[model samples]
Target: MGGAMAVRVAAAGHTLTVFNRTRAAAEAVATRCPVDVTVAGTAREAAAAADVVVVSLADDAAARATYGGSDGLVAGLAAGAVVADTSTVAPETTRALEADVRSAGGLLADTPVSGSVSSVEGGTVLVMAGGSAEAVERAAPALESFAQRIIHLGPLGSGATMKLAVNAMVFGLNQTLAEALVLAEKSGVARELAYEVIANSAVAAPFVHYKRAAFEHPESAPVAFALDLVAKDLDLATALATQVGAPVPQVELNRRIVGDAIAAGRGAEDLSALAEHLRG
Candidate 1:
């Protein structure tokens, strides 16, 4: 996601300094970007001289490690600089980071993204942001370069909450579709025929259509979103529900199914591989 966002930003003629856990990966992404790009040695170095520093790491632990300590982004960001996080982390983490950044004389915003790699590459991702109105306005133009829809959900943590809600629904619908596809296969229906029937019916949804090609030709290509990442997202979503006192039995069940898929060595496979689990 970070790589995709960086590509969009650079393609729009913005200079970029990137930092990655792997130098090779950072350089690789930089080579594809259109502007002058520098690969920083650490997160703090990446944030130090930038007007707006965007962090798009994996989770809370990674985000905290990058910005919380003495050698982190919090220590290096200039006063009045904006620290925007695009990670799908806990809302509490977002709130805490916002407070911390403000204490350090910088602004913060939680702006999580929705849509797949294709959507991101096409600059059509939906951005759900949570921050003060002024901050949202300040970030709008750059965000708009990459997002087709940018919604200011509410204050500090609302974006993270909204992202979790979106992921939960996505996981539930994806699991249902995986099961339905497997059932159709077992009934000897051609996979393409099954997908066509569903796509023509009211039961069809964006998720179903998105995974249609994968369901039709299971072994045809590499998976874009791996199973392990989906499992991690589901776990985060489940935790979010618990924090909000929302009961999500079906989400929990889907989490377990995802966990099982990962445990069965499908972690690196595309999530559409969940159809294999349903077949068993």
Candidate 2:
């Protein structure tokens, strides 16, 4: 996903210097784009050279690793540099990261995006950005190259919070859809008829429509979103719920189901693999 976003940014004519823990993967991504991307040896080197630095790590710990340390991105940021963090984490953590950037005379914008790899490649992903209006505006031209909708939600960590909220609905719906399909198939209803009915039902979401192929062919559905990532997002969601004293019984149940999916070693599979998990 980071690689794809880089391609999009470069395509938009933004000069890019990419950093990755694995140099080969970064080079592989560079090869996919016609734009010449500078390959930096260290995060500091990359952040030092760019006015707008985007960090697209997988989790909070990874985000800190990418942005922390004495020689990390924050260590070498130039004044007025805008650091865009594209990770799903706790709002408080993002705010803390923002403080680090601010101390270095730079800004941190928490930009958690939603959509599949295709959406990213096609420059149609929804970006939930959080930070000062000025910083978001400064990053807008670059963000517009990769996102269809750029929403500046609020101060630091708003994007992360919004992403968690959105994932709750997304994963919950996915789990429910899987269970519905499992129930229908086991109760003598033809799988085709069940899908046909559900696809046309009022409860059907665009996501359900998109995963129709996965529903029919769980073994072959392209992995747009993996189950392990779903579990991560759910973990963030549950934590957020607890912090706010909100009860999310359904989300809690879905989290356990995702844990089951992970325990079955389906973590690397497409999230639609839940149906296959449920079938077993």
Candidate 3:
């Protein structure tokens, strides 16, 4: 996702320096754009030199590890540099990171993206951001290059909260789709016929519509968003619910189902592979 965003930004005439734990991955991303792409040896090196530094790591632990230490972005960034975090981290972590960036005389913006690889490649992702109006305005043009819809939710950590809420719905819907397909197949209905019927129904959605091929083949192409990542997002959603004292029973259930799937060694598969469990 970060690589795709960087590609879009660079294509839009913004220079970018990328840092990844794997140098090859960073180089691979940089090779796609005709920009002054500096492959940094560490996060700090990348952050120190960039005007607007974007961190797009896996989770909170990874985000913190990339910025919390002396060699992290926080220590190496110039004063007044804008730090845009694109990682899906906890709201508290976003708040803390924002404070830390401010303490260092830098600004932080929490901007989480929503889309699959295809959507990102097409520059149609939805971006929800939370930060100061000035910071958001500063980042808007660059963000606009990659997002079809960019909404400023509120201040500081609202983007993270909004992202969690959105993922909760996605997780639930994916699970519901899996169960529905499983039930239909078990009832001796042809998978293709079931999909045709559902695709014409009111319940048919973009999610189900897109996954129809996967439902038919079961073992289709490589997974774009792996089940482990889905599980991680669900875990984040569940944690967010608990932090805000909201009872998300449905989210909790979906978390367990994804968790069980991951534990069963299906973590690397597409989230739609949840149908395999339902087939049992």
Please tell me which predicted candidate would have the highest lDDT against the true structure. Answer: 2
Residue pair clashes in candidate 3 = none
Report lDDT per candidate: 0.84, 0.88, 0.84
User: What tens digits encode model 2's per-residue C-alpha lDDT throughout 1-280?
Assistant: 8888999999988899988988898889889877898998888899999999988887888878878897699988999999888777888889888888999999889988987677789888899999999889988888888899999999888999999999899998898899999899999998878998999998788777778888888877888788888898888889999999999998899989999989989999998999999899
**RMSD (Å) of each candidate, 1 decimal:** 1.7, 1.8, 1.9
- Greater lDDT among 1 and 2 belongs to 2
Better of 2 and 3 by lDDT: 2
lDDT of 2: 0.88
Q: Against the true structure, what is each candidate's TM-score?
A: 0.93, 0.93, 0.92
Off by over 4 Å in 1: none
Error of 3 at 207 (Å): 2.7
TM-score of 1: 0.93
The regions of model 3 sitting more than 4 angstroms off are 34-36, 210-213
TM-score of 2: 0.93
